[model samples]
Every structure is written in structure tokens, then in C-alpha cells.
Target chain A: MRKILLSIAVFGLMSVSAAAQADPGDFIEPIMPPQSINLGMVDLGKKLYFDPRLSKSGFISCNSCHNLSMGGTDNLPTSIGDKWNQGPINAPTVLNSSLNLAQFWDGRAADLKAQAGGPIANPGEMGFTHTLAIGVLESIPAYVREFKQVFGKDKIDIDQVTLAIAEFEKTLVTPNSRFDEYLLGKKDALSADEMAGYQLFEESGCVACHNGAAIGGNSFQKMGVVEPYKTKSSADGRVAVTGKDADRFNFKVPTLRNVEMTYPYFHDGAANTLPEAVDTMARVQLGKKFTREENTKIVAFLKTLTGDQPNFTLPILPPSSDTTPRPTPFSK
Target chain B: MRKILLSIAVFGLMSVSAAAQADPGDFIEPIMPPQSINLGMVDLGKKLYFDPRLSKSGFISCNSCHNLSMGGTDNLPTSIGDKWNQGPINAPTVLNSSLNLAQFWDGRAADLKAQAGGPIANPGEMGFTHTLAIGVLESIPAYVREFKQVFGKDKIDIDQVTLAIAEFEKTLVTPNSRFDEYLLGKKDALSADEMAGYQLFEESGCVACHNGAAIGGNSFQKMGVVEPYKTKSSADGRVAVTGKDADRFNFKVPTLRNVEMTYPYFHDGAANTLPEAVDTMARVQLGKKFTREENTKIVAFLKTLTGDQPNFTLPILPPSSDTTPRPTPFSK
Candidate 1:
């Protein structure tokens, strides 16, 4: 009888310990750094990402709009594309984008690899066809050799280029944010005001849409759930992708991992400051209003989401060979 | 007499050794890597060099034209500047530019520091005045802090900005070329044909002006020294700086250290291939023509001048605060 009682006591203690370990608010997960990466593919992808020769103008690369230096964004209201063409929408930050359920404002591309090919061929962006981009790569002997080594293929293709670029981008996740530390059992990671703001963030229904490892990229949500959002931008949002009227104004939630670095928020880039964006979201998305102090505290808490930026050596591109095609930047 | 005879023998051997060491083609010096650099200034300058906010368009940085990935040059015939404006002359390579007697083809700016400021304020270049550039820098707290730490000044100025940029550029020397190896007593570094080409180069008097660590940046010479060369470029060359009719076609001789990489040779960038550039230089500068075989050999020798490229980590710029002035990229 005593042995049976002791076994029951031990099982009770084990259950409590397990519950405690799993219940760290249970809403958000800490973003951990990638465990491993293929170094060769990452190196090759990095070169391709910075190589502007992929564009028709030879001035726009993948890094042009999704600049890694500026929190994986251009920090412009909209991107400047080929021949200085104005981009249709605000460029989404590439940092932590791999965490997203789908890529782009409308969730058009299913993954980062698919998204990689869009900007290169888009008439409003890089302004180059897949065939031309492939031709440029095949002409460069160094790129051909690298492609052969990385993919173990004799012929280069657009699929391999995008795949390599996506591999590099997958390593661009920003980990070790203060919020992440707080979630990982660091009690003093947040100040009193920040903690209070987080409490308000959860209680006021902000957690409903923003609950995930990326804090928001786990699902699609309506921009204006409780009210209409007014903007001059002609973007139809998810309606264009889904071909359904029910999906109008619906877009994939962007990751809030490095929101402080990515300013001019929302699909139209209508809000220029954190306070302004918070106020707008509270009013339109939740039909709730916050005081000045509340807004300031929330903004302070959001700042803690900024994580360690990716550090990497600048790539030294191989010189173009004699037979390599020269870039015609000004010649349409 | 025995002691005096021993001294004479020692001195004779020492003299022979000294001659052998010093007379390794004394006309040209080997470019050595910088021994010391100010890390703080280099870090600050690298961020500033890549920052497009200094430009009115917010789309162009120093790297736009002097791209380190492509032999410190844009590899374009002429640079595409503010609002896609065509630059008057081809952008020069920044590698080993510290060895040049002066900066720019006309030697308008005496040094890199002065050259650094010209582009920012030039109407046709970055399209931003010094005052506006300073304002942009001052508005950013991170930049202001960095400037203070680097220069020990409370107020950030254009002078300090230029100084930091120049300090970073000073470290962009490419060293340890195959030619430098041969000069340093490595006999097998050069092929038989390359050695023959070097001999012909000396005999043809091409070394008259092209004799320095940078090969050709030691002096200014007339473009058509022996024969008038034709070009569609309207640049008046050094006449703009000297205000002399005699200096009409005189321009600073460009560095030939990385001639293989900095192709589309000359101020106008007319020659697309190394052989074509060699043919033109031999015909117009030296009044000597080389056979196809000789040209090929010389081209092979020139290829040996490509040195180890600069390798450094890419800078991660600080995020702009709310009070910081936003860039007006398309507000011209």
C-alpha cells in the first residue's frame, strides 16, 4: 500500500513538471537559429543574390529591394525597380520570411523559392526573363563551374538559381530577440512596462492573429476586421490570387520579428511610425482604443522584437570573361 | 693587410647581394597590403559607403559605381547616375587608387577625401548638397554616435564624413599579384610568353609613363601622345582643371594593376577587350604596333596583374528613428 502511494505521488510530480515546461504562455514560440546549413549552396546563393547582372538593367539584384543591410528591406515606401519604375506595393522584409505560411502580400508564392523567381521576371521589378537570366549565368564561366559543383549538374537552369537563392535566404532568420529570451524562460528579459504592454497585447485580442514562432506569419488575416481600411493603393489583396470576393482585403500576416527595422507599415505603407501603426490596428482591426501611455508601452515592447542581424563577409564576384555578355544598363 | 682584404671581400659580396635584391626591375614597386587600419573608422566608413541616404534618390551608394564585387568598378561604359542620368566619363576603379598622384581623370580633386565629397553634391551624380548630406547624417542617432566615436566631435560635418570614407577606401589596395611574386624572386610565377611580353613592353617604351606600384597612375599624359585618337566623348579632360589649351586632351593615367578586370578601357570605355586596349595604347601612346601573337602574349601578362581582392564583412546599418528625416527618393 505504501509503494502504491509513492508511485502515485511521483507520477503527480512528473505531470506538474511537464505541464510547467510546456506552458510558457503557449501562444508564441521562440525563434531558434538554424542548426545546420549547406555551406557551398549558401555561398553560391549569396553571390547570386548580390549579382545585379540577373536583371535587365544590370542595376537591380535580389538585394536591391530586399536589402539585408537595412533589416532585409529597402526601407523605401515602395521599391524602385527597372528604369525607376514605382513598385505596386510596399516590399515585404525578407528577414524571417521563411517562417511565413506563404510569400508576398497576397500569399501568391507558396514558398521562398517560388517567390525568388517572381521579382526576377516581373516587368515591374528586375525586368528580365528566365531565359535571359539563365543565359547570363551560363555565359559566366565561374558561375557555371559553381553551379556544377553545388548542384552536380552540367547545365544551369532557373530552378537551380532560385533554389540556391532560397537556401541562402533560409539562413537569414533573426534569432535571439529579447522577446524570444523572455519566451525561453528568462524572467528579467523584459522591463515592467514592456511586460505590462505584453499583458495588454494578449488580453486585448492582438494574440488571436499574431500567435506563432514568427509572431504573425502563421496565418492569413483581414487587414480591417472591425472597420474598413481607406487607402489610395489599388492592390486587391488576396482576391487576385484566390479569384474570390470573400478573400478581398485578406493578406498574409507579416512576421513581427524585426518590425522596428521595417517601417511604413501595412500593404500600402500608410503608417510611418510604430505608434501610428498600433493606433490604426487597434481601431480598425479590433475596435479598441489605447491611451497615449498604453501606445508608448506597446511600442517599447515591439522594439524588443529586433534580433541579431545576419553578419556575413561581402562576396567578391569573379570578373566577367572575354566572351561574357556585357550589361546594357541604359539601352532599353 | 689580411684584415683589410677580408673586409673588402665581405663588402664586395654585400654590394652584389644588395644590387640583386634592389634591381628587380626598380621602375615598378610591388603593392603591399596596408599594415594598420583604424577599425572604428573603417566600420563607420563601410556603412556610409553602402548607405544610399546620402544621395537624393536614395537608390545610389558609392558601391553603385565603385562596386567592389566587380573589380571596384561598375563595369559599365559610363555610370548611370541620379534619375538614370548618364555620366560624362567612365567611372574609374577604386582599387589601388591611393597610389595615384591625384584622383579623377582631370585631377580636379587632389585626394580621395576631396573626391568623396564631389559625388554627393554633384547635380549629375548623387544630386545632394553637402548641407543636405550632413543633415541626413545628423538626423540619425546611430550615425551621430558613430561619427562622434570615430572623429571625437559633437557636431558631424561633411569633412568628417569624407575623411571616414577616404579612410575606408585607403584599405582597398589589391596586393600579391603574380607579377609581384615574380618581382619578389619567384621565377616560375610568370610563363615564358609572359616574360617575353614584359621584355617587349619595356623595349617599346610603354613603361615611360606606366612605371609605378599602380603601373600608370603616377603621372598625367596627353591621350594622343604620338597620334590623335578619335572619340565621341565631349570631355575636355585636364583642360577643365588647368584652364590651358595645351592640357585639352591631357588626363591622369589610370592604374593598370587590375586591367584584366577593369575592362572597357580608357576614359570613354571604348575598348571592350584587353587585346583591343593593348592595340590602341601601342598605336596611339607609343607609336608602335604589335603582331597578333605579341598582343596575345602581352594580354596574358596583363592578366597576371590581377591581385587578391579586398575581403570584408558587409556592414549592417542601424535603423532610422522616427525623428530622422525620411529620404525623398523620387521628390526631385
Candidate 2:
């Protein structure tokens, strides 16, 4: 009975320490549940998300890049665009993307709605104009009826399409990770090694840039803070958006949720594994060399951040009408 | 009470007619539910179906061409493949494809498993070899575990992968179309025009090749039997597979189930609309020209083939492990 009381006392102290460590506005927080959803708009968005008819090839959709089945990323070093064109940067995960301060690697688009339009009109991406995309939707009788019901308008527009897609995207938050459970007073949720790794992560100052409900995506940070990040690709990062030479290698911090699934990490997707990524960050960002064991511990902690993935039925799109223009996939 | 008795008499007569039409070894029947599924194999296959890692680029999957969301087809005249290489023929719908006597436009593959292997290795398709694919699977711990559990094997193999994919494909049958309800004695399921079209369809020789629970896919037939098919493409159809002059211009009859959505019809995908395809098939295959009204009625009946699509949660695939080969999508 005395031994049992002693163990209980020790456990109570550990729980108090964890609670004390949970400082408000720290580097992490639980993912909030999605706010009010418009099921009609969401339904329309689901169809649009899967409808590749929006592209010139009629073969690529929002799901092609931000695939829900694969951690909202194509899992390629970079994306394959229209006619197998290689995109400039690594495609970021769209999971919990709404929590980001801005959208895209360079923070070019302000929100998911604005970011949604870039791919459809990009010459190397979906390779179609908003007018052509709208025209395709306009020709589909079922789509027209759906758009009418969702937008309260007789006609379809890119704004309505993007808005609906954004609405759906907002609901893709990943909550209830092991870390979140630990934060919510579940002391045994994480293993001792994982807890140790979390402490090292905090002590090493990695949380300065990666802290938030998203674990990142709240601000822009220089890729090579302490050293240069070498790559053959000549992307100017945020410089293209800001026209500032000083901002040459700065990029919006990508969310770490489901980081285990979103492989080939960073702007260039240079780091292929979580351990490699951690070692690289330690060397380049913190300017510190970690022992092999420390790297493993950090990776273990990172794995606990993987939350539940989004679950939804694959939406079935309506068939094109007689008036719908045929896709010219092979044409120049 | 007298009106109810008269209606009952009429309904009883209609039931008798439907029962009499259900002949043994008939050209068509209502689609049956999927026969005994090994759900574990299906679950693994579902992940593989959405896994782009099967491709050399890691951007294309079985779902890329045979998209479940869009009438089981990519809706392209021909699929855009590796490095943007255009495929020679239109992709066939995978929906209800297991019913076919053989797979592919030329009937080259014996079954779905054989067909699934072709695209992964095809230079213009997924652009990967079975050896490399197996190596990748072997490196992934989760996939290795799954393969062991499903196949009762110690190591991952290409055969097990294909078997699992085929097992999943078997469950893709679309049942309960409006036409099936009509066939099941719900006489009012189809509109008057649709019924008239069905009558014309049976009276004409369209039922000869385009029949069965799949509404086709029973055997190989000449693309243009009574008349020669015109095309800019030089593909020799089944001749390439059989190495016979007699098989020239011969191709497998594709399913007319969901024919309304599988647009750009034929092996060449020359017809862009159902009405246009009806007119062309009438002129070429049956060697009979139909009036505008007759063509409209036939198209209307074809619309009733759109049935309940496969409904399930979008599967989340296991992440690639450290030893897994990184996809060199931009390289040759």
C-alpha cells in the first residue's frame, strides 16, 4: 500500500509538469473543429474537386494535386502538370491548409479560394482559362442545376466554384493526434522517447517558426537561416511575390501534420525521409550537429503529430452535355 | 374497388411479360451483386488503386485513366501518359469490366490482373517495370506486412499485387440502373421515349454485340462490320494482338452501361456525343440509318444505364519508408 501511494504521487507530479509545460500560444495547439458548413455548397465542391473536365485535358482536377488518399499531396518531388510538364516547386499538403497565414509556398494567394484559381489557369498546370472552365460547367445540365441551387444564381462563375472548393477545404483539419491527446491531459498518450524528443525539439528552438495549431504554416521563414540550402532548381521563392532580393529564399512554413505521409520534405523536396529532414534542419536552421540517437528521437516525436486523415466518399461527377466542348488533350 | 381490381390485372400481365423475357442464356440480365469478396485483399487493392507510387513518375495510378468519379473513364479521346505521351486508343471503363471475355480494346489481356500489369510497365503509360515496382513494395514495411497478411507469403511479389488489384476491381460492378429496375418488372421505371428506344434497340441489330448484364463486353466484333471505319489513327485493333489479317479492325465491344458518361466513343473516341455515336453505329455496324427521333429515343434509353457508382471512403495509403526508392519523376 505504501509503494502504490508512492507511485501515484510520482505520476501526479509528472502530470502537473506536463500541464505547466502547456503554455498558451506555444508552438502547438489542438486542431479546432470545423465551423458551420453548408452541405449544399460542400456537395457541389466535392463534385468539382473530382471533375477533371475543368482542365483542358479533362484528366486533372483539384484532387490530382491535393489527393485526399495520399495526405493531400501528389507525393512527388514536384507536381506533374498539363502534358507532363514539371512544376517548379514541391506541391504542399492541402490538409489543414486553411490554418495557414497565406496560401502557396511564396504566400502569393491570400486564402484557399484565391489559391484554387491559380492551378486551373496556370499554363503548365490544369492549362485552361476560367472562361473555358465555366463554359464547360455551364454546358452540363446537372452542374447548372447544382450551381443554381448552391449559389442562388442561374449561371456558374469561377468565384462560386472557388468559393465552394474553399468551403470544402476548410473542413479538412486533422484533429486528435497523440500530441493533442497528451495536451488534453492524457499523460500516457506518448511514449517516454517521444516525450524526450518533444523536449529536445522545444529546447533546440525549432518551435520558434513551427509553433501553432498547424505546427507550422503561420509565417514565412528563410530556408537557410544558418547556412545555404543548395539546389539545382532556380526558384526565387518569395522574391517573385515581393520583388525583394532580401526575400530570395524565404518561403511559407509548411504544416507538419501528417508529415510522415508527406514525404520528400521542404521547398525543393530535397529531404526524402523524416530523419534526413530532421538532420538537415538541425544542421541548416539551428547550426547544430545532432548525434544519431537524437535524430531518431526527433523523428519519433514528429510521427506523433500525424492526426486522423479526412474521410469522404469519392464524389461522382455528372456527364458532359451535348453542348459541352470536347477536350483537346493532345493538341499544342 | 373496381378500379383497383383493373390495375392489379394490368400489373399481373406486365409481370408475366417481364418473366417470359427473362430467358436462360439471354444476351442481357440485371447486374448481380459482387460474388464473395476477400475484404482484406480489396482493402489493400483500394490503396494500390489510389497509389501513384506504382508509376515511374509517382503521379499516375490505375485511377488516373479509369477514374471512378467520372464514368470509370478519364473522358479523354486518348489518355495522356508518361512524359505527356498520348495513348493510341481511348481508355475503357473499368466499371463492370470483369464481365468481359478479355481485357483492353484489342482483347490482349486474359483478365483484370493481366491488364493491371500492362500499364505499370508500358513505356507510354506508367513507365515502370515489375521488378522496380516489387522492389519499392518490398522496401515499404507497411506494404510488406499487408502483402504477407493477404497472400500468406513471406515476401512481396508482383503477382500478389496484381491479384489484390484484380480483387478490388471485381467489386467495381455498378448495379441497380433504371433499366435493371425495368427488367425487374418496374415497368414505369423508364420514360415512354426510353421504352420506345429499348424496343427499337431490340428490333435493330444493336442487341447483337451490345448485350449482357454489362450491356456489352461479351466478345470481340469488328468496329465497322457492314461498313469500314474511318480514322486518322493507324492502329490495327485486334490484329496487333492476334497477328492475323482476319482480326484487322476487330475490337472488343465496350459496355454501353453508363455509355452516356463514357463519352468520345469507340476505340478511336471519334464520337463526342451519344446521339452522334448512335447515328454512326447505325450507319457503320448495323448498316442502317435512323431518323432524328429514333436516334433521340436510343440516346434517351442509353441514359438509363447510369447506375449507382461505387460508394466508399477515399482510402489513405501508408507512407513510403526510408528504404523505399524515391521517384525520379523528372528524369528519363
- Highest-lDDT candidate: 2
Taking the tens digit of each residue's C-alpha lDDT, what string does model 1 give over B1-332? 22212322333333323423344465567898876788899889889999888888777889888988888988778888887788899899999988888999999999999999999998788888899888888988899999999999899999999988988999999999999999888999999999877766655656556667888786777898778989999988999998999789888888889888787789998888899989999998777899999998888888888998878888888787787677677777
lDDT of 1 by residue, A104-209 (tens): 9999999999999999999879999899889889988899999999999999999999999999999999999999999888999999999877777766666666
**Tens-digit lDDT string for candidate 2 (B1-332):** 22212322332332323423544125468888898999999999999988888989988899999998888898888888888888999999999999998999999999999999999999899999999999888888888899999989998888898999999999999899999888888889999999888877766657666777888887677777777889977778889998999789888989999898788899988889999899999888777899999999989999998888989898988888988998777798
Query: What does the lDDT read for residue B182 in candidate 2?
Result: 85
What lDDT does candidate 1 reach at residue A263?
A: 83
Off by over 4 Å in 1: A1-25, B1-24
Each model's Cα RMSD? 8.8, 8.3
Clashing residue pairs, backbone N/CA/C < 3 A, model 2: A27-A211
Determine which window of 10 residues in candidate 2 chain B has minimal summed lDDT: B1-10
True contacts kept of each: 0.63, 0.90
- Top model by DockQ, which number? 2
TM-score for model 2? 0.93
Cα displacement (angstroms), candidate 1, residue A115, comes to 1.3
- Among the numbered candidates, top TM-score falls to 2
* lDDT at residue A212 of model 2 (Cα atoms): 77
